[model samples]
Structure formats: structure tokens, C-alpha cells
Target: MAITPNYYETLYITRPDIQEEDLAKIQQKLQDSISSNEGEIIKADKWAERNLAYEIQDHKKGTYYILVFKALPNASKEVEKHLQFYRTDILRFITLKTTEEAVNKNKASEEKKEKTEPTTPTPPPAAPPTTTAAPTPPPAAPEPPTAAPEPPPAAPEPPTAAPEPAATPPTEAPASTEEAKTENTDTQEEGGTN
Candidate 1:
């Protein structure tokens, strides 16, 4: 009494040198025809303009058009009828049903797993509170005793160290203000893309 939508996809080949205007019309026509027959065109793909494995109708090159649509079983027959009119222009086409329902069923079954299996694992990380006792830390080592206080030592003067080497700035200073900021940023950061 009711028609269930099915995932259907088909691919066809067209003339390699078809004009850009003609190409859009050709693609839209397929979509329009599908919609007219109680079908919805999900997506269309222009795979590539490729040379045929073997010559078909004396044409060695063809443009591949792939269409993915959804509709009832009878609507697919009408799609085939549209493809039948042109044997030369369109070299070949094939329609196949996508098993989406089976795929969704598999997804649902995976979701149902946690319900059937135990919510909590057999051995939980920690059981309900059974008087959680705090762990005691290890004893600290004893400090060494003070040595005898000797005579007061003389204060040493601060020793002078050699002067640090002066840094030489980059040779590649960018000419523009914008470029200078960018180059300075590049120098500051280790990541120099150029």
C-alpha cells in the first residue's frame, strides 16, 4: 500500500567534447527526469574526461557522469528507459541499489550492545566507600649536626669577568615596514616558512 524509498545510484558516459552549456543541461535533465518520476537526486559527480578502454560507437574518449538518487523500485525502471534512447551519445550506464537500510541496521545493532552487556564492568576501578584510609608518607632523613665555629674569614672582592660578545643583527632587513615586521616575527620564532 505504501512505497518505501530506496537508495539507488547510476553512472553514464557522455561525449568527451560536449560544450560546457550542453554539459550542465545534460546533468540537469537527468535530475529533472528523476524528480518527475517520484525520485530524488541526492548527488551527481563528474568523475573525469577519460579515454575509453575500447572504442564505443567510434568514440575513443568519453566524459563520465555518476548520479546517486533515491526512489521506489518502479521509478528505477523509468530511469533505465531515459538511458535507452541514446546509444551513441551515452556509451554505457549501470544502476545499482545501495544497501543503506542494512548499513543503518548494523549501526543500530552496535548501539544496542551496551544495553545487552553490563553497564558497569565486572571489576570497577574502585568499590563503594569502605573507609578510605590515607597512606602514610616515609620518614624524613635526620639533619647533620653543626660544626665548630672557626675565626671570621676575610671578605673576598667581586672578580671582574670578560665582557660578553656584541650580537650582530640580521643582514636581511626587509625594505617595507610590513615586511620588516613579518621578518622580525620570523626571526623571533624558530619556524621560518620560507
Candidate 2:
């Protein structure tokens, strides 16, 4: 039967006072153990040193390292056996079976962190040119002034009030055409007789 490998994550803490060389040696030993057990490591990184929740082996602070690998269950047990017995610098350790999805999620989060981390300083924006004034020219000879052109005449002002209308006698119009003709005939007859 084909054996299915299982993913595992191991978080191990070391003494805060451990030397760099000693720490590297300790890491190398664990890695060697994992490899010998036919396990393949996916990620191995050191976490920041910090105060521990509770002292282990009288250590209030420790340096943490994480190791994620895929291997047969028997192979993982072999690796853990080495950690539990052979290693002395390790103050505490925990190994847990994990899903491939969790491993991918962790990988993505680490990539995101690296991308957001600041890089080398960028050059500042180019500065504007300096403001020192250029050399002034020598004074020139003054010329005689000529007559200035006059502006066009202004438009006439508008009248303030309109003129009063001419006076005329008020006359009533006849109510009908027949009435108007009778009045005109009477006036003409009167004029003729006079």
C-alpha cells in the first residue's frame, strides 16, 4: 500500500542566552534528524525572541523557531523522538499535525509580510532652482516724452424725463354711424346758413 505523508508543524523554543553558533548547531541537528527520517521540510524560520508566558527550565524569555514538514507518521515520530531526548538547548517544544491548507495560508501571510517590509530609502524629489537674482543692466539714456493720444469723446447722456404731451380738447365719439352722420350734417347745414 502507498503511504500518504502527513503535514506537521513544530514550534521549539531555545534559551534566550544561547550563542548564535550554538543556536545554529542546534537547528542543524534537528534538521538533520528530520531529513534522516525521510521527511521534506517546507518552511523553517526563526521567530523573534520574546518573553515567555511562563518560565520553562527557569527561562523567562526564549527564542522560537518553526519547522513545517511533510513525512510519514512513523518518520515524524522519529524526528520528535530526537527532539524530546537528544536536544538539551531546547527549553520547550510542540509538534502538531496540520492541514495543507494551513501551510498554504502561512506561506501567503509570510509573503505578504515581506512585501510590506520597507526597502532602501528612495531619492528625495528634485529641488527647485536657486532664487539668486541675475546681474542688473546699466541705466539707459532718457528720451523726450511725446504727446499722449486722447481718448474718444464720451457718448451723450440720456434725457432724465420725457417731454409732456401736447394739450388737446376732449371730444365724445358718436355711438353709431347713423348718429355720427346726422351730427355732421347738422354742423354743415349750420355753417352753410351762416
Candidate 3:
């Protein structure tokens, strides 16, 4: 036979009326037995009294207890044997490998996260953005109008000279004798005015 290295947990139910004092005594005895057998009692959790699925020994409700312990493989058989001998209990049990220290199980590991002050002091709240500096949010951006407005480039140069400044001066004058004479004179002198 070879010894093994691992742990197992067991849960069983006992009659509900078996008062807390007796329950504690029974648990202590079991703990002692396990230690005496060269095993360590990792943890024991007692659940609130509750009803069972079926009556075992005519008791409708029972106490649910979970025991986590580490020991050789034979330790499981020892626990089962003790549970069977104690007929006062409904005596249902299970055993499995433990993944962590039972004491920390289900307990929040982050208790305020070991709070530390920030390396840099907190900055003051920001004031409402000023209209002059902070650009306006441009109203919910209308559905990108079918036509987008484009701004001309910032750089400006001298306006180019007109190509045909005199191309349409004839028709601009009213058709009157005085106007006719003025137009002929204006064209003959190349835009010389009286």
C-alpha cells in the first residue's frame, strides 16, 4: 500500500433538532479524530438548518455540514466509517480534492484593495468650457447636408485682371440718339469719357 498526497471535503446532513451545542461537540470530536489519524482539518462550514428532499430516519429537516480535510486516501474511508457509526445523523457524505485554503474560500480577497494615496494630487473639477475658446459642438451634426460647405484656403493673392472688360459695353447703353452718339464716341476713343 502507498500513501497519497491530497485533500478531500465531505458534506452530510444530520437531524435538525440535534441542537448547536451537540453539533459543535460532534464536530470537535471528528476534528480530533482526523488529527489523531495524522490528517489536517482544513475547514468546516455549517450551513443554516434546512429541509431535505426525503425523510431520512423520519426527520424532515437536517443540518448541512461541510468538512474539508487533507490526508492519505485511506482517510476518506475512516471518515465514512465514523459517519456510519453515528446513526444519530442522516449520514450522507462526499469527498473531493481541495483547490485552496478553505478559510479564504468565498471570502472577498479585495478588502478595499489596500488603499493607497495617488502619487499625484487630485486635480480640481474642470469649469464649463468657454464659448470663445472651446468650439461649439455644432448641433447634432445635421445629416451631412446633401451639399457640404467648403471654406476657401486661407492664403489670398492679387485679383487677376479681367480678360474682356470692354466686350459688352455696346449693349449696356439705352438706344437713344444721345446714347448712340455717346456709345460711338466712347468706343472710337477707347472708353474716353466727357
Write one digit per residue (lDDT tens) for candidate 1, span 143-183. 22112111111111111211111112222221232343444
Q: After superposition, how far is residue 24 of candidate 3 from its true place, in Å?
A: 3.4
Taken over the whole model, the C-alpha lDDT of each candidate is 0.62, 0.67, 0.61
State each candidate's clash count. Answer: 0, 0, 0
The TM-score of candidate 1 is: 0.47
Better of 1 and 2 by lDDT: 2
lDDT for model 2: 0.67
Per-prediction TM-score to the true structure, in the order listed: 0.47, 0.56, 0.47
- Cα lDDT of model 1 overall? 0.62
* Residue 174 in model 1: lDDT: 17
Model 1 stretches with alpha carbons more than 4 Å out: 101-194
What local lDDT score does residue 89 receive in model 2, on the 0 to 100 scale?
73
Q: Would you list the clashing residue pairs of candidate 2? A: none
